[model samples]
Target: MTVYITNAKRTPVGVKDGIFSTIEAAHLAAPVIKTLADCSAVPPDEVILGNVTGPGGNIARLSALLAGLPQSVPGFTVDRQCSSGLEAIRLGAALVASGEAQHVIAGGCESSSTSLRPEKAVFSPQSIGDPEMGIAAEWLAEREEISRKDQDDYAVLSYRRFAESIAAARFTHEIVPVGGCSVDEAALKKRPIERMAPRAKSAFQPGGTVTALNASAFNDAACAVFMTSVEAPGMKVIASAASGADPNFPAASPVPAIEKLLMKTGLSVSDIDVWEINEAFAVKIIYTARKLGIPFEKINPDGGGLALGHPYGASGAMLVLRLFYGMQQRNERFGIAAVGSAGGIGVAMLFERV
Candidate 1:
């Protein structure tokens, strides 16, 4: 059986304490869910959402209810840190392909400004080293011998690409207006990236290459896609893979996951037309591209988390959403979305235009 993603949407990415600070994660997700459900014109049998810093409890259920779905339509939430959203979409594809459901809604949401900030959750055993995300990215860059200038250059490119996309209005249709903010907050707040990126001081370690300008910020947003077993004009789910790596180098997790996915599908790097590898850190893209021999231009052509802000769980789904629209615009045949989580875990999915 084949599963098709018929529709997808996301709320505007909001910077920390920016336009969406007062909104909750579920609420941010609700509008997007409602849009997808309404557009599909088919009540989803299940709704699954990936969330990182929600207000506890079942946020997927809350968001589903808030979207005015019938109580019979059950919902659940999953957490794999950064990869939560992609995992949810992968599960939705499984449900449709397995004949367990006719239609499903899956994605992720994050409200970093409003969500509780408890003590950090344990990602790996202490012996394995569970460094904070920034520290881990810093270490990964250092280990990969990535230079400060290279990371900063990548960061500048991300900002430039994002700004250019906004100017071209490429993202207009994919965004669902919420919180009275139609534009992504980070897009508006972007400083003179070219000038600041070079002078930005190290954010994690003294003299460390990783800096605030080159790393993604905590953001609030939500994204989801409608999946169905029935054939349609949309991207078809080809395959998915989940893999793990050293906890201390969580940013590099996507490398193994994408490798596993390619191995599973028996496809090579050149076969993929577009790549949506999460840009939590510039090093993530640098390392993955270098390892996989993928061209830099093919990855996140609309910019990535570095410029748009990373809304944790939702950022993963954002990758799919971008791929869906991007492939359509460019008339591409194959695309892939890959995300690395905080716990040395990664998820990658392949999609082909149907």
Candidate 2:
């Protein structure tokens, strides 16, 4: 069976304590889900969502109900930390592939400003060194020899690309207005990254290259895609893979995951026309691109988490949402969306324009 992404929608990303601060995760996701379902004109058999910081319940079900979905449409939430969103999509595609469901609504939602958060989620045993995310980025930067200037320059490029995309109105169609805010809050706030990146102080460790400007900020957003086993006008879900690396090197996890995905699909890096890897930190993109030998220009063509903000659970699905529209813009053939998460886990999904 083949699964196709027929429609998708996402709320404009808001920084932590920003526009979405007052909204709950379920409420934040409901509008996007309703928009997708209504646009596709297909009642989803199931609703799946990825969320990391929700208030401990079936957020997917809550969001589905809030969207006025029929009670027969059951829902569930997946939690894989940062990869939850992509994992949700992968599971939806699986349902279609297995003939268990013809149509499904799947995506991710996050409300960092409102959700309950633990200081640390215990990714690994103490002996294994469960470092925080920022520390992980610091380690990856030091190991990869990614200098402060390199990360700073990359960050500047991200902001610039994002700004350019906004000017071109590339994100206009993908966003669904929420709370009277139609645009991504961060996009409206211009930053002089080039002027401040070099002068920015280390955020994680002494002499570390990781800084606030080079790292993605906590955010609130929701994005979902409509998938169906029926033939449709969109991209076909090809395959997906998940892998793990050492917890201490979480930022490098996407490499092995992408490798496994390509191996499973029997495709080469050169065969992929576009790549969408979550930029939780500039080093994540810098390191993964180098390891995969993928050109920087081919990755995150519309910018990434660094410039758009990383709403943890929502970020992975946001990657697919961006990829779906981006491939349309470029008329690209094959693309992939991948994310490396907290517990050294990584997920990658391949898509082919249809």
Q: Which residue pairs show backbone clashes in model 1?
A: none
- Worst-scoring 10-residue span by lDDT in model 1: 113-122
Question: Candidate 1 lDDT, tens digit per residue, 270-300?
Answer: 9999999898999889989998999999999
lDDT tens readout by residue for model 2, 136-236: 89988888899888898889988988999999999999998999999999888978889989988999898889999999898999999999998988889
- Where does the lowest 10-residue lDDT sum fall in candidate 2? 113-122
